[model samples]
Target chain A: MQAKLDKSDCMFLISDEKLNQFQQMIDELDLFTLVLPFVEESYQRSIWILDIWYSISNEEINRISNPENTMIYPYRNSILGIIKTLPIKRYIQLALYENERLAFLCAIYIYNELDDFISKKMAIKEEVKENFDALKKYSNKSLRPFFDSKYIEYENYPKKLAMLQNTVVNELHEIHKKYEIPLSWTFEKAIDDASKVYEAVFGLINDWGGRVP
Target chain B: MIISNQIEHLKNLYKDLKFLEVIQFGTITLPITLQEKRYDDALICYQYLASAYYENGSYENFHVVMTEYEKLCLTYGKDENKMYFYYLYSLLQVIVRDFDAAVEATKKSIKYAHFLKYHDLIVVNYYNIAAQLVHKKELEKARIGMSLAKFYKNNICESNITIVRGYIGALYYFATMGNNEEFQEVKQVFLKLIKDRQTFYDAKISFAEAILTLNLGQLEESVIFFEYAYLRFKEQQNIMFLINIEEYINNFNLGDKFQYTKELREIIKNSHRKPLDINNVKSVLSDLFEDDTSTLSIKYPNVISKELIVQHVEHALQNNETLYCFHWCFITDEIEELFGKLFVEQLLFTLFETVYHFIFKHNAEVNVLSKNEGEAFIRGISESEFFELLMELEEKLQSKVVHSKMGILEVPIHFGFIHSNQLPEKQASYEQLTAHADASLYYAKSHGQLYIYN
Candidate 1:
């Protein structure tokens, strides 16, 4: 709300009568916004706990790919079912019902949580195994310096960038390859995409505007 | 003063929580104790050796050790020896996960203690049975056993550390059994007994507390207790038990616990424990536990002020952190009317001491709040974790009953909590957080819920 107050355009407060109505809306909204902090963290954790279900790195990929781990598919699929169907739609409905823009942070938190579990087997540059291990150890955001260093060689392997472009431009079957290892996208790119989901839940406000009253 | 260096070395290693080291060093001393016919010393050595075998997961070697221990029991068994034998056997039975056998052994030990007129051991045995019965989920039998434990509580010899240790743990089982009257009686003795004596991290007691709380659907409380047990096991460096705690967290799906149990996860990732090669160790001794032993003798709080809790809230806001501040209010005005004001003071004192003692053992940083109101400030947690931990602490505290000389008074606890994350300002917002907690407490007090989180 402070962000909205400080950062709003003069057009949003064009008239004295409009400004008074905005104040009235905020007074009513504070009653519901007071409960969103609780909603935000619960949804945030509900998202993070899905980390164990994701098979990200090659080692994790291999571990889950093992025949012995086949039984865990049903459980993982159940979680995926919830992620794919329930939350995104439900949180949108919630924001609409509450008539509050901040309530949509719950949806974004859930989106970011499910985004981390998006995994596919990709062959990266074979030489950067050490860099792969380091990336596994730390975040791509923090490891940006390592990638940009003088001796690094991440020319063309990750495939995620091309995958994203293909996703935008092509049909569903045309986007994914059957089995061609590429050097176009790096693990760095993949993690960066996930980490780009700003932690808006903890410090959420209604600056983005509410529903039409 | 004339203790054998070998026996002294073994005992020292045992006391240091180095059970595996004790097993390695004790291979030589067990034969020496047997050759000398030091029955008392041999019995004590067997107790130490069995404990090591238990912790080391050398159960096959433990079976041989028990066989040898029984021979010595039969040969030199008098009332004192027999009582001690059954007691040790019962303890070892628990190590083997045989609850029924342990209860039967405890009953036999009780009989011998009865014959020998060893009142402290009798109380110890009864409470031991109560503990075992509770573990078996035979709560009705456990309640009866708890009553017998109380009947002999007056005879607990403080000098006998074993008896003192045994009786001090009785306070939790009544809480576990939900026997309010028995819980009240034991609560009094528990507070008075532990007041002067110090406490060590008993992993066994911590395990029981963790499991009992978990069974009560108090997952947050269980994780906190399990965390304490994990720390205790860390001090012992028992890789297997530490891993077991990790499994329990994963299995129970406790408290968004993957990150919460990160240390255990690290241990599981890094350490690989091989089962103890008892055959190799026993080959050195020529027999696993050719025991000679001696009788054993054993020897062995911070509170949060309200102002400090508010200050921590302010500090957290300044630093962009969160603090879960609990204002635990005791609804004792009715108690003051029913009993006198003086009796309520003692009940509050018990509450204060128990809370303080718990805080001290966990090394939680805080001061003693005033008698009537208590506070716990858990720093930097997510809201979900706060609710889990709040439910746990509230149940544990609300179940607290005091047995004053006037009568048993179950103090009604109302826990109100607030976090700094919800506040608007960094500078003067501490008052808002605390007043929110105060209002939460007032709501809980009036509404009669266990807690209200603001």
Candidate 2:
């Protein structure tokens, strides 16, 4: 009797080739796996990373749109939530994840580039900081600043640098959309993701670009 | 804390008594120029004006202002001032019964209040938040929030903190696992204030004293203090205090032989038929009479039986030896036989009855009124000498005939009565023993102008 060729097995076989191509694309773009290195093995750590990533950029988007309303309690609190969750430890770890090394390297490079770009435009930071301090004193009153400092920083970055940063933020947005997660929860999740990425990258690099001799 | 135009208006009103009166008289308008739109302006203005009016004793204007404020908040608004306005507006809503709206607005107000470091407002917001949580049966969270509110009030507030503290204590006392000690402790704090005479108003102090006495089962003492409080309130034109007293009196006046109680009940009933300020008392009486006693096994109703009533009268008679002459004299001969004189109770009853009859039957002449002078009169004398002096006075007042020359029934009729004056304030014995003498003396003096030291 002829062996029945299992259709499902054939489908899986076909998908393995596509998986290979997808991995190759991930390597080339360094984007698909950008968050992967940041994600810990544990479900909670992964979720935390997701939260951080989503809230930070979503807050940035809100600050960009209503720059006039940026320094108010709700707006400033949203930004502060992101600032508090920035994964200082995990940003250095993303390099060591087998599938996410490229994405890990790229996220840091993009984040640094954006920070550098904002620093270069000293005027915007000064103005934003002034308004932020004013808000501290008179918290009851709503504060509106003259310029969109967050957007100005975004626009001033080099095109490629900007694209990479935008891609990382978009990936967070996509993860949030896929998970049906709240923006705040997603930002919280992303802090863990970023910390994992930091650990992976540091681990990968500290091994002298290889395993311990 | 914001020191907005509302505060400015309040400052103006409080500048002088005339301005306060003027604020009451005219169409009181709040400074609404601060906000951009009329609706938002009115929304904020109404709260400030209402509070100002309330503080200034302009209740009519306060009501009007709150009504206007309610309308502005309910109207649709996307204005930036909506959240800010809602903070004050929601607090006002609680005073009215827009509880659902207050709950919603309170959450938003808390967020704003925290941002501003307005601790007082934050405390109020927390109170409302806790109240809402309680309504939803979120007791644990409500308790936590209430604790936080109390913490803030303790740290920041000065005068009105007692009110919030009392509220918390009451909530703990009734709704939670608070013991009698907890309730008694709060009560003692207030009681101490009353006992020390630190409380300014006599009526207020007496009312608190009455409550404390009642809680301690000093029911007769409580009634006397309540009467004092009731009279003081009436003299002061304080309708609210009068109502509170009437309510308490109605709860306790279930006894059989209390003649004053019947008089009081009739007066209160007549007052209620008119638009007297004692509507609360009327309602309280109606509720107590309508409800079954099983809910609270209070001692009052049972203590009103005929035998118990007679015992109370007897006890009152013993307290003041002279008051034995008023109502005790006329016990039926049958009662005297059944409760024989060989029994101490019967002997005391008979003595009281005999005194009562003796005082009423004849015009007993009481000529001299003199205070008890233990020190001034007997300081130089020895114990024996002091005894001789007392015997001399006793003989002179009781039997010796120091008559005039013409002798027209001129034996000086001076009763050697012990005066109740110059008594130490804290002596329980004085209170326990003196009332009967004073009452009898007072009755004697009123009836026949008899001179008795009391």
Candidate 3:
């Protein structure tokens, strides 16, 4: 009945205060159309990053309790320290490679946050309208169809969510099986993966001149 | 998916007492589950298979399955499954008449059940404890245990608890206390429950009824009920109950009408008795003749023969002499497996030899009824003398150290006795006396005592 926790040597480097601020931004950015997909994609991407960290790290971290102290921060510092010394082109390549599968998730999060602000109060607020128009100009063409087609109304949301979750679990199972990871490693791996993806997207937005919503 | 469905079906079959089908289904599923690395499923399969084997009286299969079950419990089983494993293990011990070991197993079961907060399992274990106590004749302790069981049953929600056994215990308690009115009241309730529930198919209910009827002085009705119960048990292949029923039937002199002649013939045919050689027969006859000085010429046709022994004992019964016949049954192969073949054989031999010497030393006429089977008949002893002799024998057996090739050991022996004069007929045959004694011996063995008399 007692489940063993993962002992992978990866850690979340973000402080509790910064994590709280990021969570607030997510809440404010929530729209039914974009937030569901963003949440699902972030969950999948987080697990992937955690799996990669577990495969690469030599240090065994106790992930059962106090993940920040025991696992996440150490992993974050190690990864960041290694990446900071890399050339700008190499850093860019690494970010792009990691964020490729997570592109739809980030685009949906950004578009929903912008659409909600524009529809709700942008017309009456000139500053808000200006910021929204600028954000739209910078938005990728690949993410435009999501807003134009009213996809949320046409799709079976529950079925889509279930299919997405099944895909994520199957992928995680494959990774674990391939690496001969113990069952105990699963839960901690998911938590570390989600936080890493969140941090990566947050940094990317900061570089792209977008403040936290 | 199909496997899960089949497992559910097997469970239903087990509940319905289709034990054969359950075993068949479990046999197929057990390997499949193991092959798939579903150890949890394998444990469940073993549970069903072992129980089915037990119900069917296939002790060999039961033993094999239980071994596997124990191993599974160690590896894959949780506390809940371990509790059930101990519970079933206790039942196996009970079947083998290892009451002490059974009590210990039940204690273990109670411990696990308590830790798991399984109130129903606790109630069942308490009931099992009460039953064992009753067998040990610790009536007060048994009543207390049964009271605890009842308390748990009442406190638990919507419990489908049957109070038939509780009523039976109360009946025994009052009967033993000589409280006729209370005994009658409890017997009425017990009988009513059996009737209303149509539980006559269960041999135990019939056996209990037979005992109650015998206590009420309805000997004829008791024989009929006992026979009904015995035949039912035989039909169900419940060998343990059959053996107990045989004992109860033998204790009373039911005359030729309820002698169980057919069953006796079956047993005799199956049994391989070793006949005494001519010289050994002569020596035994000479010893008997030399021991007796009475004018009554005892006719010894053949020595170490059941018929010759019965005839000689019947002569004493006809003369209105106070005579006691002691009946003993060796542990069968099934029992031997549980208690170890060597231990059982050695114990049987030692007890028979000790009793033979003690009876001879006491100036009683003893004859070996069936040497290979460990059965004997003794006569020319009064009822009081018989009881005193048993008490002495019990004390001696308890204290006597048996020196074997392995080491020194003390083996427990149980026997049964019946006085010829106690038979209903003034001119009862040797068969009647021996039967009664045999029945008494069964009671003695079951009750964890040295001897039971009628």
Candidate 4:
């Protein structure tokens, strides 16, 4: 499940039967709870499967080979497995949407993997060895220009993923009230999640210096 | 006072130092100081905020900022500085639909600018005024304004020439005169501007293209561009624009009675014999034509139709089969002068997508007659013609219309036309028969709009 993703590693095939099944479910289920199932299988190693499956669904997971394919996986995975990775401390932080705590937790879990993927992709190093050596050579103040240049440049991200995230977040909020989720938790989670991702990315960049402050 | 490059740099540094952290923390400061409070800081602040808001897609804020800027300028002193702010203010007014104010502001700005010998401000003022006059449907005034603007814009900076904006000037000029050739030429230029990313005015360019095509009686082309514009407007959440597009579509009447009558007959003919209880009409239509529904909607009604339930059936058919083209093409050639090229093209795209989606989503089996087929269908073909021979046998049986006979019958007919001289009415009913023949031809094409007696 955690194999290096290559062009040939994945194929997107929608069988007529599968489409029908999804359509049928769409008709019957509340659209908010509507989930499309996807599974990745590897021979033996339950822990590895669990880690990969959870990682695949998590938003913080970097290196999303196929965005559309990876997107459906989060909704397709086991809810319990997803919830377990969302530590109690994180869960409490998401207490703003207390009633829909489970849903927020699920979203946060997915958000984590997404954040990780985005950070890793944007985190530029001149060369593995060069960046590693920069830490030994350059002081923090000397690194200002290099870091400043990074922030000034804008990168285009696929809009569909952004739309998908917003849609999912909105749908969760729609269901939160019925499931007893508080609006506050949703807002808090967004802020916290964004901050944590930013901090983590900053740490990753700092790590190229090869010595933790 | 004028400053050298070195001093200008110092000025910029001083300004940056004055407002740096405040700007970062979301504060906007004017480069000009208001010692006497005779001028308005609100004008500069709102203008800067509006620029940022436009970038962020907060159109609501953009409107608010513009409105505030306008109010500030309206109340502030009239001077050289006023000329510069007035030009910017008028541009915003044009965008925000305050066309009258925009026109007035541009005029005032130009007068003050010339008096102050502010050449750059004069060009900006006149250019923006011309743009607003176009919006106000003042074609002659807009043209005069453009000529004046161009005279100055040309002399100042060769690199700063807004070629795309100039094309917009040409679009309005040709559109107002109803000169189809010139309109097309200007439209092509504006479209090239959009494709080349020469302007941030993609929506405006699209709107202009939609309007020009619509004015040229190119309904299909106009609708496509209008739909694109509609989507962009929706993203911007410009409610006023949304309403304008909706109203424009609602009033679009092609005005040709013959075409109207023909379209009516086509609609009526296709309205009968629809599958009941299928959410997906296209899939049902597919099954109706091809005798296959493995790929069709699973939900099917117990009865196709019951005479006792005629009203309900008719309502269902109407809901399922109707294709509504918003018809952005209805705006007279006169109104084409009122909109920019981008606005018109966007309106056209919106109309096209709406109608296309309605047609495609409602009837699965409805085959889109190829352009050649459509032409062939509308124009009658003789018996010796290939389509005539194909439909000859189907006409002989006249079996396609009967509901029970609908299943598993391949009618030999050219969907292009039928020489049905004896369509069950008097010889005086020749016009009616021709109309039905067109409907039958449409049916034979087995596009969802046509059905035959099985």
Give per-residue CA lDDT, model 4, range B275-335, as digits (tens): 2221211111111221121111122232121121223323433344221110011121222
Tens digits of per-residue lDDT for model 1, B201-280: 35645765676677677777777778888887777665656766776787888738534477677776776655433232
Off by over 4 Å in 3: A1-213, B15-20, B56-60, B160-201, B252-257, B268-454
- All candidates' TM-scores? 0.34, 0.30, 0.37, 0.30
Candidate 4 stretches with Cα past 4 Å from truth are A1-213, B1-45, B51-59, B67-78, B88-98, B116-121, B131-138, B157-200, B253-454
Question: Who is ahead in TM-score, 1 or 3?
Answer: 3
Candidate 2's DockQ is 0.00
Interface RMSD, in order shown: 28.2, 35.8, 38.1, 32.1
Best by TM-score: 3
Give one digit per residue, the lDDT tens place, for model 2 in A1-213.
001111111111223343343334433333222223211112222222222232332323333222322222233233334444444334222322332433333333333332233223322445544443333232211111111132233233223322333443443334334443344344344434444344432333444223333
What's the TM for model 3?
Answer: 0.37
lDDT-best of 3 and 4: 3
- Model 2 chain A: ten consecutive residues of lowest lDDT: A1-10
lDDT tens digits, residues B1-454, model 2?
Answer: 2334544554444332233343443233344333435554454455445544543333345556555554454443332234444554554444444566665566555544544545656566665566555655556555655655555566574533223312332333222322346445545554543353222244554666676566667778777777787676655544444555666676765233223455555555665433322211111111121122211212223212222333443443346422211111112233334444344343333333333233323322111101110001111224354345434543433342223344523222222122222323222122222223333332333333232323
DockQ of each: 0.01, 0.00, 0.00, 0.01
Highest lDDT: give the candidate number.
Answer: 3
Q: Candidate 2 falls in which docking quality class? A: incorrect
Per-residue error (Å), model 3, residue B114: 2.2
Each candidate's B-chain TM-score, in sequence, is 0.46, 0.33, 0.50, 0.41
Against the reference, the lDDT scores of all candidates come to: 0.49, 0.38, 0.51, 0.38
Q: Rank the candidates by lDDT, best first.
A: 3, 1, 4, 2
Error of 4 at B408 (Å): 99
